[model samples]
Every structure is written in C-alpha cells, then in structure tokens.
Target: MYYQCFFFLQIDRQFLRISTVPLLSTFFAELDRYSPRLMEIFSRKGRQAGKEITQIMDAISKDDTIHTRRACVIKSLCTYLNEDPEKLVKAYLDSDFELQSTMEQTVMGVYVILIEGALPDDDPADIAVLIEGVEVLSDLNSIAQACALLFGLIYCLNLSYPQQLKCT
Candidate 1:
C-alpha cells in the first residue's frame, strides 16, 4: 500500500510538471510582453536573492567561515522568530533546539534538523524533517529541498506553523 501510494504521488507530481510547463511559459511570456520592466525587475531581484542565499549557505556549510560570518545568517534566520542569536546558536550546537518544543512540554508539529560538519573538508551537511519528535524524512540534499518538503507536509497534514515562526 505504501509503495502504491508513493507510485501515485510520483505520477501525480510528473503530471503536474507536464501540465504546468506550458501554462507557466505562456503566463511569463505574456507578462514580459505586457510589462518588460516589471519582468526585468523580478528577474534581477530573483537572481540577487539567489546569489545572496548561496553565499550565506556556503558560509554556513564551512565550519571555519561560519564562526566569522554566521552573524548575518543567524540574525536573518531568527528575525521572524524574535529569538536571541546567542541562545539559538547554543541550543542549535547542543542539538536541543526544536521548533515548537519548550522546557515544559513538546508540541506536536514538524521540525527541521540541519547537521553540518565540524571540519571544512568534511562531507556536505544532511537535513532532516521530523514530526512529533519522530524523523519522517532524512538525508535530504539541501535546506531548500528540506524546507519545501516541510511546507508540503504542513499543508498536507493541515498543521499550523510553529508559534515563533508564524511570520516566516
């Protein structure tokens, strides 16, 4: 049954891709024709955000650079949560951070774990998404992929975002 469900999911996802390609292409072509300046601004902003995210990720994945450069990244991450960077860093390093877990009780919700190497030459980091403290997905290739899956699970399960990260 699990295999059958997975097969259907794959088929559905492939069908979505097949059906949306031309629709998206036509939409974008029309938007470009209607407002070339708007399209250019969107393209430039997207490329700039992509480059910035890539730089931040690269810094985060490198243990040495992280020590010196993670301030901006950490601040950006915690901005929506209204969290203190020092405490968050400590909790993250100790593997004690949970999205919805507190000292008194653990809330039932999805959480993401990103494990990076201690050394610069080490292998790439691994990402995991858990629910109710149980890992549901592991060894995801990237934070983006893990986050995408996390959002998908939240939507599919009809779960609310964590309180602190509600704005995110």
Candidate 2:
C-alpha cells in the first residue's frame, strides 16, 4: 500500500546488537530488511550487496536474486505509486519527463506492489504471487520480479539481516 523506506548507513558495532524492534516495525510485514542501525554497526564491512544482505535475508530459500537492480526498481515503484490518479500511466509519463532522460535501467525499474494506506485490501498472498513470478520472468519482467521477490522476502520471511545490505 503505502511505501516508505528507512535508510541506515555507516554504523559501528556497539549499537548493532540492541533490540531489533525499531528496525522491524519499518516494514508493514516481515519488517526487517537489515535494520538501519545494523548498517551503522557494520559499515566496516563495506558494501557487499548480495551475500552480505542475503546473510540476514532469511534462512529459508531465496525465490530470486536481483541484488544489483534494487535501487532502480525502488525508485520506479515509488514513482508509480505516487502517480496522479486522474491521468494514470500517460500522465505519469508526461509529468515525469525527466524519467525519459534517465538511463534505461532506471526508467525500467521493477518492484513488488504493496498496498496499504487506505487501499482496497492488503493481502500478503498478493505479495506471494509477485515472488512466484521472479524465477520465470524475462528481461523487462525481471525488474518487477525482483521487486516482488523483495516484498516476499520481507513479508513472508520474518527475519532481520540489517547487517546484510551494502550500498557500495
């Protein structure tokens, strides 16, 4: 539904071990995607995207692996959800002229659609469907698949790996 992300950066170890409640509440479901404080704690590790982030993603199986594409998709999905209602996609395109000038990857970001904040329904199963599509998607679909997979990881897998994600 409503989407917002809490970014934690460059943290040292002393604060990393504190109770993870504040970190977990961020996600509407399965809230821990490497808590912000963890990042503050583990900045020493540098940015190890996939493995580092994955280490705390969940112990269960990963449905897809699109670590490299997350940032772009997050931007796109954010843009999509925030679009003006009357015009729909066309208006979104018109209003986002800057998007046309963006790099191809940026313009075509993928993300899982989470519904909240006065939306019709916020079913986690819908998020599950997004996850299932990941492995089978093609190029264009990959971005969407990746986003959906992330939603599944956060919603379905209830673990916190704030120490896992790395920006660099």
Candidate 3:
C-alpha cells in the first residue's frame, strides 16, 4: 500500500510537471500527501514513466467529468503497473475494506471502491462481478442512488458522457 501510494505520487508529479494540459491540475493537487522521494523515482525512470504519462494524458482527452478523467488516469496507471482494473476491483472486494450493510449499499460501496482504485492487490476473475454490481446498484429506487451508480460505471469504463447523451 505504501509503495502504491508512492507510485501514484510520482505519476502525479510527472503529470503535473511535464504536461502542458491543466485538466488534471486540481486532481493532482489533492495528492500532496506523497513525498519528494516519489518524484525522484519518477525522475530516475523518466523514459518509461514518460510514455505511461503520455498515455494517461491521451486517455483524459475524451473525458469531461473529473470522475471519468480520474478513471482513465487510474486505468492508464494500471497498465503501467501491469495490473488489470477488473482484477484490482475483485481484490478490493475480497479485502477487509468496509462495506455497507444492505445489498444496495454494498453495491454502492463496491462502486466507490472500484472507481477510486482503493485497493492494492491482485485477484483474477471475470469483470462481470463489477458490471453486475453496478447494474444492480443502478436498479435501486432512489434517483440519487441510480445516478451515483451510473456515474460510477461511466467513471469505471472512462465513457464519454457527452457522446452517450447524444446517443440516448
């Protein structure tokens, strides 16, 4: 977990320092907890990290919402780390992270977990679990709850809301 945080910190620095695009400025600023050592590691591995950061920036191009943009960033970072989003999600569910009591609440919990990439572990499984969980959450009665789930899925998949809105 410590190393994972460090890794993100370095990536955050690289994104902020080199990229001319300021789309993620606010997002990166929120990660100030990571120290300068992480920035040093990023400097040392400039070639590789540079390529990954470029990919991340490209991913953010299609997103309008911060939720969706951050999701793309996480997905790109996962690729850089040789990790899969689905596997990371499953591992998060299996860990001791706190979950809500009801199934609906639990679905919301999982939605938040996957969207945030809060877990730092590996477990392989079909991504269907995540899809199903989000679908279930989307079916709940409250409009607010349903919207939250929908936004969570959009973020998870890095979907363009404007494009989808046009399609609908």
Candidate 4:
C-alpha cells in the first residue's frame, strides 16, 4: 500500500524523493518551526524515543489502519514540507502541520497503531513501523528501511483501512 502510494506500481508512477541531506538536519528543520507543537503532543502522551517499550504500547493502542495510513500519508505531506519548509511555516495558516499537528506525533501515532498492543512480541510487521519512524535515520539505507517498513505495514493492513480519500 505504501509502495503503491509513493511509487505506484500500476498508477501514476513516480519516485519517492530521498533527501541527500542529513536526517538530523531534516528533523531539526521541522523541529525549528513546530517543536513546541510537536512537544505538546509528544508530552501529552509521554512519548520518548528512548523508551522503546512505551512507544510500542502507544503504537498498539492507536487504530491500526489509521495509524498505518497516517504514517504513510505523512510521507507525502512531509516531502512537500521538506521541499518548501519556509512556505508551510510562514504561509498555510491553516497549515497541515497545524491541522495535523507536528510531523513527529502523527508518525508516532502510526508507530503505535502498528504495535497494536502493550504486550511485546517479535513481529516483523511491527518492527517495520519502528524502522520507518527512526528520526536520526539519514542514509539511503535507513530511508529504504523506513520505506520498506511502511510498505509492509500498508500491504498487510490495507483491507482494514483504506487510504484517506482527499479528492473525488
């Protein structure tokens, strides 16, 4: 599903832009504009990247299909934001970031959904979500891993939840 979204197999074929830029730089750029908003949401649920276990619990609690799709949609929204970071911040007052809130929280919400329960188990599908959301991930390998996880999540969960239908 995620693969089809970004790199459609049979529809409008396009490539997912892999930023040659460093991951930390990309994360900081968004953080600069939306840190407070991101923090508020992150803190609301006590999200801590360091706390792997809690994060898994959070992901599991979220609506699985919603979480997966949101995580994937975030890629589309985030890529736009990445290309024109200044615009989304200065313009788009009804910003998707504002409407959707920070990029991180929404991604985390997706992560939570993939986990689908507080209890821990070694599930490849669950691990994929976490792989996709790793913030410091900068290299192509990491980005590829992220994409792979997203694809697996979406492919596995598509029937339960369809992608957001924004247009007619």
Best by TM-score: 1
TM-score of 4: 0.20
How would you encode candidate 4's per-residue C-alpha lDDT over 71-127 as one tens digit per residue?
Answer: 323332333222221111111122233432333333321222122333332222221
Candidate 3 accuracy as lDDT: 0.36
Worst 10-residue lDDT window for candidate 3 reads 120-129
Which pairs of residues collide in model 4? 59-112, 59-113, 60-112, 60-116, 60-117
Q: Point out the higher-scoring one by lDDT: 2 or 3.
A: 3
The order by descending lDDT is 1, 3, 4, 2
Higher-scoring candidate on lDDT, 1 or 3:
1
Point out the higher-scoring one by TM-score: 1 or 4. 1
Deviation from native of the Cα of residue 40 in model 2, angstroms: 4.5
Model 1 alpha-carbon miss at residue 158, Å: 1.4
Query: Which ranges of candidate 2 are over 4 A from the true structure?
Result: 1-29, 32-37, 46-98, 103-168
lDDT of each: 0.40, 0.29, 0.36, 0.30
| TM per candidate | 0.42, 0.19, 0.27, 0.20
Backbone clashes under 3 angstroms, per model: 0, 14, 0, 5
Give a tens-digit lDDT track for model 1, residues 62-104. Answer: 5534222323343334432344322222212225455335422
Pick by lDDT: which candidate is best?
Answer: 1
lDDT of 3 by residue, 42-62 (tens): 334446655665654463355
Runs in model 4 deviating more than 4 A are 1-13, 16-36, 45-168
